[model samples]
Target: MKLLLTSGGITNDSIHAALEDLLGMPVGEADALVVPTAQWGHPMCGPASVRGLVAATPSFRHFTALPWASLGVLELTALPTVGKDRWVPWVEAADVLLVDGGDATYLAHWLRESGLAALLPELHGTVWVGMSAGSMALTPRIGQDFVEWAGAPDDRTLGVVDFSIFPHLGAFPGNSLEHAERWAADLDNPAYALDEQSALTVVDGVVDVVSEGEWHLLRS
Candidate 1:
């Protein structure tokens, strides 16, 4: 499976270029799957803003939020709300899975509660794109120190990779690289802090930098 794990949105030219490379020619080109970790189809969200972020241009496939997943049962629905008619098909017919940015803790819980957490790795044979919390949520643990939210955190994760990802690296002070370094030092694990415009692409378990932004690996 081709995985494009990004720090945040496709806000940089290098990131965009890599994304285009992942999407080959049309027709045989892969379908797209969009999972929003932040806001579900909110107007202001990056996933909702881009043209191919969720679906094909001029037309698309959309699947509205499925029933809350909590354990053993899987919920299936053909109903289309909002743009599901345009969004659902893409999901059903995609060669790619795009995970948008949002609250990492909430997103991780939702995926676990819904049981989609187990199906992530099987999404190979196609491109798997994750941005911001989408990317961080795939790790064994997430950086929750800076986020302010309610409810308990679910340690359940996709485990596609074994690292804690911190988004908005240098974008702010709360979750900056320095903070990540300190946190990682305390935990004594390899941690990566990605800037808003940066991304880390992992293909077949191998990882490499994708953008011009900087990333710091904390030391204990």
Candidate 2:
């Protein structure tokens, strides 16, 4: 699997170049499916938000928003059966699956319940790009602070990645480098703190950090 995890979306030349390299083609030629389900119920989850996100990275000529929130109420057991007709085709067709940030727990719930988690491994050529909460949802567990902030019950996550991600470091009301350092100190698993200009790239299973901003890795 190929993943680009960011605190913010593509914000610099290096990140853009990395994405281009991952695509193995011009960004304009790629087809992207933007999943803004994490932003669901928020005022920013509408068409305007989609437009703004797409504008920030104008490389993809074809962009489609797949609001997964519509299926949020369905039973988790029903997801695999229902998703075949509704989401499978879209996921299979896209070259990129761009997940937007909002509430990580909310996103994780839908991803699991809607069967996206089960299908992700089958997306052979697709690039998974995540911003903020979207990035955090892919990890084994989220920080306790973030779980509390999101008003969620637990820090458990999708576990797509073995470690945890502390995003928006040094630039937010949510987190700072100092805070991340404190959090990492207590964690048994590897943790990464990333600022807006930085990203964590995973190709197959190797991890690489790319940044124009600040980032840190904590392992104990």
Candidate 3:
């Protein structure tokens, strides 16, 4: 599996280069299925937000949002049983899957509920790109600080990656490097704290950190 997990989407030259390397082609030639399902519980989660995100990463040949929320089922098991003709084909056709930031729990719930988690393994060359909450949801578990911050009911995640990510390190309002460090210090599993200009790239089972700003890894 190939993944570009970021605090913010392709925000700088280094990150852009990393993405290009992963794609093995200019981003303009690639198509993406943007999953903004994580933004469901936020007030700013709307068409404009999605548009702005797409605009920032102008390389995609096409960027479209998957309407997972429209289905309305709360349980993860309901997704595979229901037919998702509107988005499934688009997901299959895209070269990348772009996930935006919001509440990690909310995002994970929909990803599993929409059957995207199961379908991911079948997407051989499709790059999984995640930003902020999108990045966090792919971890084995959500860190305590994040669960408390979001008031999320559970810390469970998709477990697509072994380590947990703490995004927007020293970049988010009210968050600082100290706060991230404290959180990482308490985690039993491997953890990473990433700023806006940093990303965690994972290929097969190897992990690499690409950054233009600040980042750190914590392991015990």
Q: Which structure is stronger by TM-score: 1 or 3?
A: 3
Which regions of candidate 2 deviate over 4 angstroms? 41-82, 148-151
Task: Write out the backbone clash pairs for model 3.
Answer: none
- Local accuracy of candidate 1 as per-residue lDDT tens digits, 1-220: 6666776555667876666566553323344445644443233445444434333333222111211111111111112223445533444456656676555566666676554555556655566667776686677666446333355354434566766677788777577666777767644346677776677777777777776777665531
The order of the candidates by lDDT, greatest first, is 2, 3, 1
lDDT of 2 by residue, 1-220 (tens): 5898988877888988888788776666777766776765244366676555545434322122222121111222345676578767767777777777766777788787788888889887888888888798899787777663344567788999888999988787648777898888767789999988999899988899999988888763
TM-score pick, better of 1 and 2:
2
Best by lDDT: 2
| Model 2 worst lDDT run, 10 consecutive residues | 66-75
Poorest stretch of ten by lDDT in candidate 3: 65-74
**What is candidate 3's local distance difference test score?**
0.73
True-structure RMSD, every candidate: 8.2, 5.5, 5.5
| Candidate 3 ranges with C-alpha deviation above 4 Å | 43-86, 148-152
The predicted structure with the larger lDDT, 1 or 2, is 2
Worst 10 residues of 1 by lDDT: 66-75
Residue 147 of model 3, lDDT score = 58
